[model samples]
Target: MHRSAPRLSRILACAAVPVMLVAVGCSSDSGSDGKKNAGSSSSGTASSKPSEPTVEPAKFTDLPDPCTSIGKKTIEDLVPEAKKKGGTAGGSTDLSVRGSCSWNGLDDQGVKGSQYHWMDVGFTRFDSDQALGSGAKRATEDYGKQVTKTKATEGAKKAAAEPAAGIGEEATLVTYGLSKTDEDFVYATVVARTGNVVVTLTYNGAGYAGAKTPSSGDIVKGAQKAIKEAIASVEKTAGADASSPAKDDAKTDAEDTKKDDADAKGDAGSEDSPKSKATPKS
Candidate 1:
């Protein structure tokens, strides 16, 4: 009987060893699964962040040249004249406006893509001289004042000055461009009054890549004619009277006329005059 008890105890011990090994193996597999789940969760969070917005370039179908659309007697026609005065005309494109144009080209600065020319012409009979004069004066004075203020704020000993000939009455022109390193070059001119009306033109240009540097003088020489032509185009369409009402003014005038007509009709209806009312079923 004692020998039988000893054999039974050995058999029980052997069975207990396999159960202990299985528990350890299961624990290791659970740990590995937990790590895989954590890695997946981290990857999901990274993909949820937003990106910055980008400005898309302008696009349009090919159309007639901007200069060609200008009337023969218009200031835009004077582009050839201005070119005769030693100015360069760049490539011209339509800006989608019925009578507007955008001209782009190089100036004497030898800087490519340095010019953006825009022109608008209005065919209405309103005089644009006053409006042109006002806009040009405002632009010139405002530009100077802004530059002066900026210099003062920066604690400069003296402000940079501009030439008297730089300001004019027939055009309000602005030029700005960026260098390769993103430096800014900005300029503007205003021509407020012209022979038959007002002309306003603006120019803006920048160089993105080049070993050669562009001077302010080069920029001016290259862009001045384009700017003048744009303003001339504007003047020809809108005329020289700069002080004329805005485009929206026409809508206001139409509304007023409608109200006047309604009131007049009301007054005529209130009258007892037989002539004011048709005889009912005469």
Candidate 2:
């Protein structure tokens, strides 16, 4: 038995070598097939990598707080007898994107009559959507609808919509007179757009008892000032510079004039060169 030990060892070694080789071969084949399958799937699969849609980023990421957008003094002047000095916050589904502040006062003079005034301001912000449109563009579209709706107020009289300047990119002033509660009411709505934000200022007043009806001119002037403040607030919230919109327009106009002058000079030089280059006919 001692003499046959080497022979048994050799036989065991030979048997183990074949089994190891077979196992290795199987593993190699499996690995190679897996790599091929992976490569094929990568090339043939339609959704190897998904792409995300891109949209233009809005100029303003958020809207200003409606209650604080206008100055305290402005509100005080507009609503002398306002129930809330801070202005009444309108119900809002989302305060970050949309909000409103309103003020109303009914000044009673007993025999002289009472004066009723209501002033409210609202801010709506639009986000840049790939499927819908850019923020500025979208706001412009909504602005038209808002103006039309204001003009079509049920009992509005002498309704007039005139293009407004110096407020925002574009603005419309809708002024109308209405008779409600047996008193004459003056209404002025200014729809303004600043960047991606739209501002709507609705102000109406009626003298209840006998207070002389508020002047439409006065209402419009107040609305314009208030709207300017609102636009400035929006710009501040958006991190924009403190430049007035009127200054921006003036700069643009100056640039246009310079370009026109340069163009005119180029045309004049071209005409003079042609005349100088032309040889005198014999």
Candidate 3:
């Protein structure tokens, strides 16, 4: 009976060995499948990673020289007898980003009194930034700010602003009166934006001695004429491929401005007798 018991025990032990091997094989397969799944999950996560957002490229990487932006003839017409026919460059640390030129003069008319003229053009260029936005979009925002600031000039009187067409992608003309040097001055400022650049031109004139202050319409016309040239200069700095509708607009504006000036020659008050009341300033 003892011998029979020992043999049966041996058979049971052999059966248990097969069961253990089967369990180990199943566990090995499960572990291999788990490792493969983990690898696949990691690969999928890497492959599905999101990409960074992109921004529009900036246009007109550089700016035109503000001093020479206007032609000599234009300067002569705007500031007759100008002390410096070549406009004076305003202080600028970085000409690439921002620049300005100013011209001022007093034309003596003997018994008719002296006429004072002052004009300045400024350019500001913006670069595209992924965080901020496109260059043109940034310039548009700055265009609105500049218009608002011009309208809120200190001691301004009868300040008014209106959209100016055929100047740039967008433009605004702000006219106002300011009392300075014991005389009233008429001022017209044109704020325009083209691509990534902003062009601001301010033209103001006052009568010295007995001369009549310039009329608002004439001043506006002069400002628009000058700014159109200044804005076009930006495209010149840009490569030839950068040509845009702004150029055509400027050409049309120039023709119209010239005709308008000829029609209002006598009414300008600077050349002939005082006709209309003087307009407002800076």
Candidate 4:
């Protein structure tokens, strides 16, 4: 039997149609699966969000000038021949948030002896952040850290920590000794947190040549005094006067005295006045 060419061509085309349809079906299935995966990924991504904790409001918003935070007299006492009496400011990207200053010098006494001294002060201010905590709380935490850091300094000896009074809301003084330049150096670091600001003051000194080594008590006292001034500066930046604490104490004392006077007067009047009508004097 002889088959016609046209019929042969139609038979081949008919066979190709099923193959093309199957390929299309397979492609459609792949596309559908891709769409499903994309949708699932998008859904999961949209549902993922990190949770945050509730925190209290911050206290202070600005920091003081680190170089001027401490008094000039204090610097002179700490560093007798400081190269820069105003102190050298530390690097800071945000001046209102954090700042530091340092002074180091060697006092030459011409045949008597030479002494070396170093004083540094830093101010860290925290702002209220929703994800973190209140500025005051954050400052307090950092204050503790500074104290610990001073106590755990490498090569430190005779390290001790004690509460610092009359400086701020919370404060600690860490005292330690380290050997340098073939001489023993005494160090005192004051870590204080007031409101939302934290103040860290470190003072260390050593006798050079043949001078006497600085006393720990003196270093501690000087650091405390410097810290007090720094605390006042922190308050000043927030628009509080330097004499605020003293003023508050005076006002409180006056009020208490007035109250006592009133009470005393009342008592005296009661003594003179009888509950019932006083009988004729006998």
The candidate scoring highest on TM-score is 3
Candidate 1 residues 15-48, lDDT tens each?
9999999999999999999999999998999777
lDDT ranking from best to worst?
A: 3, 2, 4, 1
Off by over 4 Å in 3: 1-36, 39-43, 46-49, 239-282
Query: Which candidate number maximizes lDDT?
Result: 3
Query: Candidate 1 regions off by >4 Å?
Result: 46-48, 53-64, 75-282
TM-score of candidate 1 against the unseen true structure: 0.32
Prediction RMSDs, each to the true structure: 18.0, 11.5, 16.0, 12.4
Question: Residue 240 lDDT in model 2?
Answer: 40
* lDDT tens readout by residue for model 4, 127-217: 7778677777778788878888888999999888889889899898888899986899999988888988888889989987788998888
TM-score of each: 0.32, 0.65, 0.74, 0.65
Name the TM-score of candidate 3.
0.74
Q: lDDT per residue, candidate 2, 172-270, as tens digits?
A: 999999987678899999999987788999998888756899998889998988888988888888544345799989999999999999998878778
Clashing pairs in 3: 176-280, 176-281, 177-280, 177-281, 178-281, 186-280
Q: Ten residues in a row with the worst lDDT in model 3?
A: 270-279
